[model samples]
Target chain A: MTKPNEFAPAWQVAEAIRSGDVPAEDVTRAALDRIAALDPKVNAFTDVTAERALTEARQVDADRAAGKTLGPLAGVPMAAKNLFDITGISTRAGSKINRELPPAEEDGELLKRLSAAGAILLGGLNMGEYAYDFTGENDHDGACRNPHDTARMAGGSSSGSGAAVAAGLVSLALGSDTNGSIRVPSSFCGTFGLKPTYGRLTRYGTFPFCDSLDHLGPFARSVRDLALAYDVMQGPDPRDHACANRPAEPALPSLNEGISDLRIAVLGGYFSTDGMPEAAAALAPVAKALDADKTIDADGIDAGRAAAFIITNCESSRLHLPNLRARADDFDQDTRDRFLAGAMLPASWYVRALQVRHWYREMFAKLFETVDILLAPATPFPAPLIGQRTIEIRGKEMLTRPNIGLFTQPISAIGLPVCAVPVFSGEMPLGVQVIGAPWREDLCLRVAGHLEKEGVAVAQAPSGF
Target chain B: MTMSDDDFDSEAFIRTMAPSLGLSLDEERVAGVSVFLSIAKGMADILDAAPVPENSLELASVFDAGQTAQQAKAE
Candidate 1:
């Protein structure tokens, strides 16, 4: 009976449990114990389902005794951002308003997929209110602290998802990325995150913020773990009308394929890391390691980013109009103010923004025709302090909330698949987005895998975790 | 849709539109919401300035009833 290492990647953990080196119950208990001990500091898990987790782990053991074939993720523990329903619990979606909603009768589509693939549910993690945030600060559940530095942010709406994985509380986490929710946390927490193409995964059974711009993804310690989770969750669900009518395209099979002849380039101009030395430093190593020398520009980037902001504001505010009208005072001041302003945006502005989105989508479609992958910084800088509001970039002070997503929003606006791979430099780690064309998630993952193998991108645990 | 007019009043727009949309704008939050609206206005201006060729684009539609119905039938 070997002790279960909580910090091991999901692939290794699953292999250990399958080989009888570690019992499923021990692995599950280890994660639960870690969450109980450290979650008070990280504030990652909003709810920990210890009893249910042990029951599920025992079933895995029982199946092994009967010689039944186990799933790939058998005996591995994982958690989802609270936005995903976990049956019998109120899907808080990181807002006080949703806390009063009826408990979900069933799990979300992604959770169900992960469960069927042999992953044990460790309950819901914390996030920003209604997934309408970049920083993981929630008025109801308190700020999700960065695992690296407890005083700083955990990059959110998937705040808990990233923090939980980085803190070794869980092997993998599920998160939603509307405009960098997954990537921001991944960058700040130094985890490998995948924001698959919009419509790549079904959005059914989860609370949504900007329906037009919202995306759901996974965060993990290793690139292979990210790909493994992604492979199982891929497929169309009729429940979510926005989900693409496409079959599952597994990236795990080709994950080891080296980037031999893939045309790679860095996005210049709009993605210029001018005056932001940390981001520039992070991208330089990734570009050099990949032998990527070409620098290209996407003309529609400015318009695309602007369009994302307008569409997000319009759609999210409209979705919460009823609550805004009835319980406006109950909402977080920052979230409430933004939604209120969003509601006032003219329909004409929204319509134009969508047109710009269409234009931007085509622009990327063309850009990918020449290059298989494009490289850019995931965040303009590292994670900011939890309560800090403003940051200075290029000698000009700007709002931290909106500015944090500058690099991420434009890419997600057109719904491209991007993998944010962390590059450990100085004290705090930064991330670089290895972006790919629509539905070419394998390319991004493959590059990330190469970087991980070369030690260029790594998810090193924070000290004393 | 252009925001060329420098005299546009964000507070006035909020006062008028919030009531129309059934959202009550409290005085304290009004100033805060107005600042957000002003930020949104700046972003909108960027979209206005970009030259989007007419023939190459359309609104990115999330729902297509006919296409969805056909896909469901096929499946």
Candidate 2:
């Protein structure tokens, strides 16, 4: 019989539940018990749906008794970021200002689909206020702590999604990435997170950060779980016009296909600069594991990052115009100031920046014609101390809040699929993004799987979990 | 209100120009927004310096012929 307290992968848990060796209820109960015991230190959850989780697990057990076929993630415990609506909660979105809005009419589309795939909702996870933050510190909810070292930061805005998985509170959770919400948190907390291609997964029922750039996806401890969660949650939706009208290409069947004919390289030039020694050191083993040789120069990345910053400012500011005017006092100070500044930007700058985005995307298109995958450090450095503000990279100090997304922003700006795979030094865990061409998540996952198999990249659960 | 010259004190700029623009901002809010704008303006300066080609303003819609081929073959 499988041990209830064991930290098993989602795939293993599903198989255990299927074989009736460990009942789904016992597994769910163990996860809930862990959350209750350790969440005070980690602050990974804003809410824990104990009743809902037990109910879902019972149904899975009942189905197995009746000889019904189980889904790929049957009986797997999961949670969603607070930005996702959970039917009866006022999608607080990690902000004081949004708490009073009426409860969401229904669960977000992603949750509904995951439930159908037999993943139970443990609850909603904590996030940065209004999802505008890169650092995991939240003004409304407490700061989501790194599982490895409680005093260190868990990068956000998908703060709790990463910490929970790393702490073994739950095996899977969902988070959104506008710039680097999913990837940054995944890096800091030492977990695997997938930011699927923009327009790949439907974004219906999630809080909007920047509609043009918003992408919803999953986080987990293993690459297989990342691909499994992504494959199940994807498809077309009329409500999210940005979601492409394409059939779901399930990644499970090809996840273990290996990186046989794949051509991989590390991003040079801009990606090489501003990295901490430890952060830069994490990439060497991954390169050796996949035999990645060629160096690709991604020119104009700085301008792309700046353009993304402007677009985020312009779009998010407009979205919050009504709320900002009425109750700016209710918002986190960091979120409030950025929105107000964006509102004041010259219209010409926003438009010109969007045009520049087009130029940059065109450049990537031509560049992707040759390379199959590109690897880059997910964050410039490992998780900073919880309250530390400035990062000294090569003698120059930069603000910690915005520069945390330095490496992630440029890739996200153009809507590419990136899988953040955890790598480690002596104690702290770091991550490198296995990047793919737009809609080529298969290649990225293949490379990530290769690294995981080689022990070069793997999610190390925080000690004492 | 605007960058009339180079004498750009963030606090003074918002304080002097906010009234004409009909925005009644508290001192804290104005101070916050000013600092945020100053940082963003620094980023915009880097972008504004990068030379973009003429007539390349249309949004680039991505198309993957290779994926299309792979899909068709699978079918």
Candidate 3:
């Protein structure tokens, strides 16, 4: 194999592998080599399954020689957030105790689907402990740092996911976004991340954070890669109640259909407020590129964010109660304390929040009537300094961690399909969420792809890589 | 009604609530617990004040087992 595009997007890599311009083993080995050389500084990987990856690569070459059909994602190197179950290793979900659980007997549904599509999993990447964090600083595992600047955060709990993709460590990686886990890192690390509608993809083998809000999706260097990964991973699973009976929906066919005829609108009100100048400034070019001239009011943002907070706390706390009881000392202090707090919430409040969720979803439904897509900032600011605690947003100091999700939480609260598209401004990358009506991830990807084609948005490989 | 800001003392509240959930809290954990509880409470307040139709309670049942959670954003 000569001149393999090691840092190229997954689509390009697949094209190369298919044409015999580059051997699958060469591409896979190149990725493993890069990880060995740079991952120490980036902290993007918790484990690198080099042997498994090469073994899978060998099959691709063998299949081609024997004249077998290739999958859409065939021969691509990828990794998953540590939360997803892989056979023979306990799903870490970024925690000491979780890693102690027995090894999974079978791969999770998502992993199985990706593998069938010919995407080789390099290994699991690092994440926030228990999927309850916004910062990628895992207490058990080391912090996943930004590839653009080692001193900055990659965002979390999908920290390693964002860093790995942005650093070009892999062409594709998977991350779960309950509240901006995918988008936050996408914005900070300059990668494309998708949080498909809740239940759009099966979450059967992944560790749960909140049943109502959890979503499993991908992070990639291009919108097409995001669409390709999502399209391949779409289908139903009997094991995941949320995923059952949902017809397979593919977004790749219309991904480049352009947003010229689509009624794109910028989300205003709560979305426009409290953004730092740099963060707020990033949205203008995206809106201008799409010709987004109209603004829609999102009145229930506060209620939605509040409901998300309550529901996430209550549900996650309940899920971890047994652990909290048996081994509270073993859990991260912040995670344990948050769970304890959720346990203390009144039952009535949780019920009331659920009621409000219905109301919140309706508000978004009404907003979507005249809008095909909504554009909003993905984070209040770019990646914050590692170990830094507070940020000044619109001239007011705010806690860095909770406020990181200020824009993302409201949208995900009601399970909107949002693709976090990166916007470059000099050094660090900021992002905007290309949001669509429920089950309309196609529209979001279309808008993101349109921006990529216009050269208005693109993921820049970090210099550190 | 028990959601009053003045009535909420996080330390005292956790002390009272921990035993029921089989927990023992240390001071280091208290500050973190305090922050989270207040955020949870803040969210509850907004949802409580929002107007809702009488049948809103049953909408979330779709998230239950053997049921399709595919309907009702309530327009």
Candidate 4:
């Protein structure tokens, strides 16, 4: 029997429930009990849907007893970043602005699908306000501290989702990635996070930051679990215009295919030049595992990053223009200032950015003809301390918020599938980002799994969980 | 497209543009806007140094056409 306190993968938990070795209700009870005892210190959940989770677990138990069909995720407890709408709960979106908004009449499409698949909703988690900043330091709601070391920051804006899963409070959780929201937290909190190809997962009812860049995905302790959750959440929704009108591809079956013949590349230049020795050091084993070839020049990367920033800021400003005009003071100083800067950008500049985006995408397409996946550091460095404004990297000082997404922003700009795998360097956690061509989530996961199997990266539950 | 350093603190320019753009700007809001404008102005200066292509066309519809092609393929 798996120890109650030990970190059990979601698939293992599901199998245990299926085999009747452990009842779904008993597992749910244990999870809730763990959350009840551990969450106050971890602050993983903003709301604990204890009553609803229990009621749902009971239904799963009743269904199992009747020999009814079980969903793939049957009776697993999961949470969404607070930005997602859970029927009857106001989607605060980690900001005070939406606090008084009416409760959602229906669960977001993602939530509804996950629930239909038999995953219990444990409630919404915390995030960076408006999902703007990368650091999980929420001023309105207290900053979600890193579970590994309380003084450190949980990478944002899916801070709580990352911390909760890493701390073993939940096996699976939903996180939105716009400029590495999911990947950063997963990297910092030491877990596996997947930012599927843009439009692969429906974004209906989820709050928008930058419609073009915003991607909804999963964070889990294992790559397989992330793939399982992603497979369930995928499929076109008529409601989301960005969603691709295609049938969902099976991600799990491909995970077992292995990466023997895959053409892998170590993204050099921009990816290799920056920050902490640990960040660069974490990539060596991944490169060796994949026998990755060096590619990607540094010249165009800055332009890619600049274009992504311009698009993110301009669209974000447009989204918040009304509130920014009405209640500018209500936002955190950082988010407010960034929005203000975005609002001042000229229309022509934004237009030029779009043109540049086209050129960059074509450039990536040319590169992908030779390589199936590109591996790079997820963040320039590991999670910095909360409230840190500047960090020293390679003897040069760098801004924390904007630079953290240096490697991540460029890839997301092109709408690639990226899985951030946490590599343990000594006591701290660092991550290597594996990016695949558009709609190649399975390839990304396969490569990530290869890294895990080869011991290139290891996932560990945060200490004192 | 070139802007001088003085453009960073163009409070009067921002105040005039704010209401025209439907933005709120009280004294405090003006101060915030000023700081932001400074950063934008700095970034804008850097961005302006690069020359634009004479035949540069807007790329918004690039994805739109590709999306249509993809949808047609799916059908």
The reply for model 2, stretches above 4 Å from the true place, is: A273-275, B1-22, B60-75
Question: lDDT tens string, model 3, A1-465?
Answer: 345465688988887788778878888899999999999998989988899899999999999888888888889999999999988889989999987799888878888899999998899999998999888998888889999999999899899999999998899999999989999999999999999998899998899999888999999998899999999899877667666467888999999888878999998888884447777678989999999989887787888888888889999999999988888888876588888899889898888878788887987898888889999999988899988898898788988888999999998998999999999975789999999999999999999999999988899877757
Candidate 4, residue A397: how far the Cα is off, in Å: 1.5
RMSD of candidate 2 to the true fold? 4.6
Where does model 1 sit among the CAPRI classes?
Answer: medium
Poorest 10 consecutive residues by lDDT, candidate 1 chain A? A1-10
TM-score of each: 0.97, 0.94, 0.96, 0.94
Candidates, ranked, DockQ: 1, 3, 4, 2
Best by DockQ: 1
Q: Could you give me the TM-score of model 4 versus the true structure? A: 0.94
Q: Which numbered prediction scores highest in lDDT against the true structure?
A: 1
Per-residue accuracy of model 1 over A169-219 as CA lDDT, tens digit each: 999899999889999999999999999999999988999898888899999
Model 2 Cα shift for residue A66 (angstroms) = 0.9
Q: Native-vs-model 1 lDDT?
A: 0.91
Cα lDDT tens digits for candidate 4, A364-426: 888889889888889888889989999977678977887788778888987899999999875
Q: What is the C-alpha lDDT of each candidate?
A: 0.91, 0.87, 0.87, 0.82
Q: Determine the C-alpha RMSD for candidate 3 after optimal superposition of all C-alphas.
A: 3.3
**Model 2 per-residue lDDT tens digits across residues A13-119:** 99889988888899999889889999999998998889989999999999999999988899999999999999888999998888899988999999999999999
Clashes of each: 0, 0, 0, 0
Off by over 4 Å in 3: A273-275, B1-3, B54-58, B63-75
